[model samples]
Target: MSFIALHPLRTFSDTWRHRYLLAQLIKRDVLLRYRGAVFGVLWIFLSPLFMLAVFAFVFGNIFQSRWPEQTGGMPFWLLLYCGLIAFNIFAETVSRAPTSVRGYPSFVKKIIFPVHILPVVPVGVALVHGTFNFLVLLAALSWSGNFHAHALLFPLLLLPLLLLALGISWFVAAWGVYIKDMTQIVPMLVQMLMFVSPVFYPASAVPAALRPFYDYNPLGTVIESTRSAVTGQSIDWRAWGVALGFCMAACMLGYAFFQHSRDEFADAL
Candidate 1:
């Protein structure tokens, strides 16, 4: 009997059919994060809220430094909140991706599973947290009377960030199986990347010559654009278009690299 080989699309379809398994995996991942916390799942909403309050109180009131180019007359706190939403997702995904597959060695050895989707669990959990954070931002903005019509563009602006996270996760997750050091390295790198990506500061903070780098950097573009969307500030459409193209290309390249390296995972592990 001649056998047919399943294409990647076919493999994805087969994987999608196992939605129940995916859901169970996602739930376990989500719950595990809060297992030892005091408030448990409430931390999902509370953590960011607490952080935002601290920033608003410290930077907005105590220091009283007016951040340049305030968006729609929004407080610096609200502007930071807008950028933090997208930054948090990328941070969560990149920090967690390295451990995603390694943490589930048994799944690789014992179960017949679509192992490729394993890297996505962290991203899924992060997105859930980000959704909560977004709600909190909306409430804060509305309370402050800065919730502008441009807020509708926030999600569309974040699409590049989501893609970039997915791409980097695939790469890091694949490398993680081979090098145990990735667990330590990735989180530190993500922290550094966070500062460099314009989360807590504006791209304008960069020097004029360095501005091009910030404009073209995929992570920086998303952060700035998402902030713009929420603040009714005009977006640098050209920079954002460049970021979109870079993210899409990176995603394709990362997936190809991941698939190429996937076969070696079991042996490396």
Candidate 2:
């Protein structure tokens, strides 16, 4: 049996053709998370606020953390939270990706389904939650008297990250069907990545030997650029441009890989 085309053009076409189906899937995924809870959809807003409070107490109160050469009047926790907004978009999407496809055996085996959209669903849900988190961040910044017009660029600044997260999600979702270990391993790696990234500290604080790696890391670059946008600091467009190019390439390659391996999914699942 012939498999789906591996060309990036075909992948894009499939996505656009099934956009409505993808939308319903994304909606279902979001609602399922809160379906039984008394808090319901409010958790989308409350969850991140609770996380922010925990981070603020642990880092701001206990460690007395501050960004290096911290120039903005923005509080340390808010600064930390700004970078975290970008990271969480990526982290939350990737953390759930492993099961995006594997968790849907009925979709694979019992129906003629466009399974490629399964991976995209997690990223879509993440963006929905991330948007709520961004709003919360904006409110917090306004309260702190550090709000800026540059914060409006926050969604644009996240484009590279969205592309990057989608690419990685597709790859891991496919691999997860074959390797149960991926479900466990991906989260740990995500946690490790959060620490290495400039979420808690400035990129300047990293040792000289590791600076190049941080600069080249697409996730780190996006987080830093996003932080700059929120803080009214100048974003490094050159670095962001490079990250965008790399992320586009990754998106294409990941789509190709997922399509190529998808023919085996019915048997595997």
Candidate 2 lDDT, tens digit per residue, 22-91? 9999999899989999999999999988987887788778987767787647778888888888998899
Name the lDDT of candidate 1: 0.80
lDDT of 1 by residue, 85-204 (tens): 899899998899998889888776654677778887777788889888988888898898988888878878888888788778878999999999999999999988887888878888
Q: What is the C-alpha lDDT of each candidate?
A: 0.80, 0.88
Using all chains and alpha carbons, the TM-scores for the candidates as numbered come to: 0.89, 0.93
Cα deviation of 57, candidate 1, in Å: 1.3
